[model samples]
Structure formats: structure tokens, C-alpha cells
Target: VGRYLVQLPRGALSAHDDALRRAGIRVRRGGAVLGAGGKASLGPLSPARRKPPSSSPRLDAITLQEQLERALRERQARPTGICPVREALHGALLEELAGTIARDEPRRGTLLRRVAGEARMTIDAYRTVYEKSLLFGASKLSEAAALKGNLEGRIAELQAETASLADEVRSLTDLCESLEHRAQRAEAQAEAETHDASALRAEGEQLQGLLDALRPG
Candidate 1:
């Protein structure tokens, strides 16, 4: 047989004793004694509980943002020019700096506390510099576009001139061909006239021979 001791809230003690009696278990109210050879145990009426581990770190978004802002501010304080390419370089630099800050060796909170203010200021400064640089780059690109357009217009004009020249050459070639054909026709006409003249001369000589024979010489 097993023996057990149970502790209960004063209000629940009477109810517990009644239930134990109904179950044929011996009931003793406060300060009960256990008999020899009776095994005893305690506890089973409360809900199980758990607590979160104390070692885990908490994330602080505000501190991290502040740190980033400070780093950006420092970068902004550095002298920079307003060119598109330069602005792009500055943006890249800021991004790299942000990444380094995010991957700092110390705890995130400690690193943030150390650098947050400066990073914020640097970010603002970099923003202005980058914007200006972008504007300058856009202007330069616009100028380059205009220059390209002008060059294209000139090329088009040259092409048109070349086409005109080609057309003139074609016309000249046609005229030359016509002139050669006319020259050939003229030469053929001249040869025919010369043959007729030779035939007329032979006939005149034959007539003269007949006249001489008639004149009895």
C-alpha cells in the first residue's frame, strides 16, 4: 500500500477530503503523518509552466536606425562633387559602409549605440551629394544626346548629297551612251554616202569611154 501527502488551499481542503473519503482513501486534514512502509509522494494539481531563455538578445530597431543615420551623416560631411558618376560612387560607398556597420563584430546593440548618430548625419549628407551628382549626370547626358542628334543630321545631309551625286553620275552615263549610239549611226550614214560617190564616179568613166569610141579615136 502507498501513502501520500497533499497540500491544498484552505478553501479547497474540505472538498478534497470529501473526495478522498468517497474514493476509500484515508483522509487527514493539515499536518498529516505517514505510516511506516507506506510510500509517499507530493504534487499533481497545478499547470506546467515555462520561461524564455535569458541568454537570447533582443533586437532594437530604433537604435539600429539611429546608427545607420549617423554613419550616413559622416559620409555626407565628407567633401564630394556633383557629377552623376561621382554620385553613383558615393551611393555605392554609403551602401558598403551600411553593410559593414550591419556586419560589425560587436553586439548589434553596442555597435549601434557607438555609431548610430554619426551614421544618420552621414546618410543625409550623402543623399544631397548623390542627388546633385545625378542632376549633373543628367545634364551631361542631355548634352551628349544633342550632340549625337547633330551628328546624325550631318550624316543624313551627307548621305543625301551622295545620293544626288550618284543620280548625276547615272544621268551622265545615260547621256554618254546616247551620244555613242548617235556617233555610230552618223558613221554608218557617212560610209553609205562615200560608196554612192564611188559608184557615180565609175559610171561617169564608163560614159566617157563610150563617147571616145563614138568620136572615132
Candidate 2:
């Protein structure tokens, strides 16, 4: 009903206001609708006033019930359409229903109170469970996020260390290659020196034989 009023065009709402006024309901600011005798109209869009249940009214249940039936019959007789008159009739019907309930509730008040108390307790229990679950889930999510960050940091450190080790390995490999080339050259020079020494020794022996052959002995 509040949404209906809010969405209504200004012109249409004005018309509704007039109809509601004729029906003894005043449309107040903030979507409050006060019916005759200062009773607040009950609706999803209306804020309900908190009041203790009253003692049953002096009115006879049968008489009030007849009036309620008559009002319902009158409302059903009207043509259905989106109009101020229809809205007025609907509000009047609701007032009749509320009046009937208020007048009749005393007879069943005890049972109603007990049921209401049980319902409140049930709602509170569910709310507590839901809040605990939500907190637990949030805590677990925070922990998981922290763990993921730590693992990522560790992985980054390992990758940097691996790169450094690879650089050292390359340096050692280059040094080893240079030393191998030097060793090969040394081996070649040693072989040439050996050949030269062998040739000189042979020549010395041959010259000694030539001198002996040339000497008269």
C-alpha cells in the first residue's frame, strides 16, 4: 500500500487523499494512515504501533460480526478498478477486520500469548546460530587468504634463489672451459719438447761414432 501510494502520480494521489479523507482516514507524512478514532491502519508499508492488547470492548461480538459481514458484502459489490474510491473501500474493510480482532481477542488471549512467546524464542535461536556461522566463515576466509599470501612470498624467494644459483653455475662452467684449453696447450708443448730432446741425444751418439771412426786406434 505504501509502495502504491509512493508510485502514484501526484494527481492520482491527491484524488486518493480526498477519498481517504471522506472515509475518515487521514494520509499522513511518512506513509502513515490513521483511521477513525486515531487507530493506525495495519499494513506491510505502515509502521505498526506497539501497544498491549486491550480488554475486550463492551460491544457484542454478534453485532460487531454482523457489521463486519455487511462491510465485506458492500466491498465485494463494488466494481474492481484502480481508483480512489476502491482504495477507500479497501482501507475501510481493513479497519473492520482489525476492529473484529481487537474485540474478539480477549477470549483467546492466553493461548495467543503463549504461541507468540514460543515464536519469539525460536526466532532468537535461529538468529544466534546464523550470526555464529557467519563469523566462523569470515574467520576461515581470512586465514585462507593469509596462508595464500605466505605461500606466494615463499615461492617468489625460491625463484630468486634459483636464478642466482644458475648464474653461479654459468660462471664456473666458463672458468672450467678456459682451464681445459690451457691444459691442452701445455700437453702439446710437453710432447714437442720430448721429441726435440730425443733427436739431440741421437745426434750426440752419432757424432761420437764418427769421431771414433776418424781416429787411428
lDDT comparing candidate 2 with the true structure? 0.64
Residues 103-137 of candidate 1 have per-residue lDDT tens digits of 54446535554565576578669888888899999
lDDT per residue for candidate 2 within 117-140, as digits (tens), equals: 676578668768978988999999
> How many clashes (backbone N, Cα, C below 3 Å) per candidate?
18, 0
The total number of steric clashes, by the backbone 3 Å criterion, in model 2 comes to 0
- Residue 56, model 1: lDDT of 25
User: Could you list the CA RMSD of all candidates, in the order they appear?
Assistant: 18.8, 15.7
Candidate 1 TM-score over all chains jointly? 0.43
lDDT of each: 0.61, 0.64
- Looking at candidate 1, the ten consecutive residues that score lowest on lDDT are 44-53
TM-score of 2: 0.43
lDDT of 2 at 2: 25
Clashing pairs in 2: none
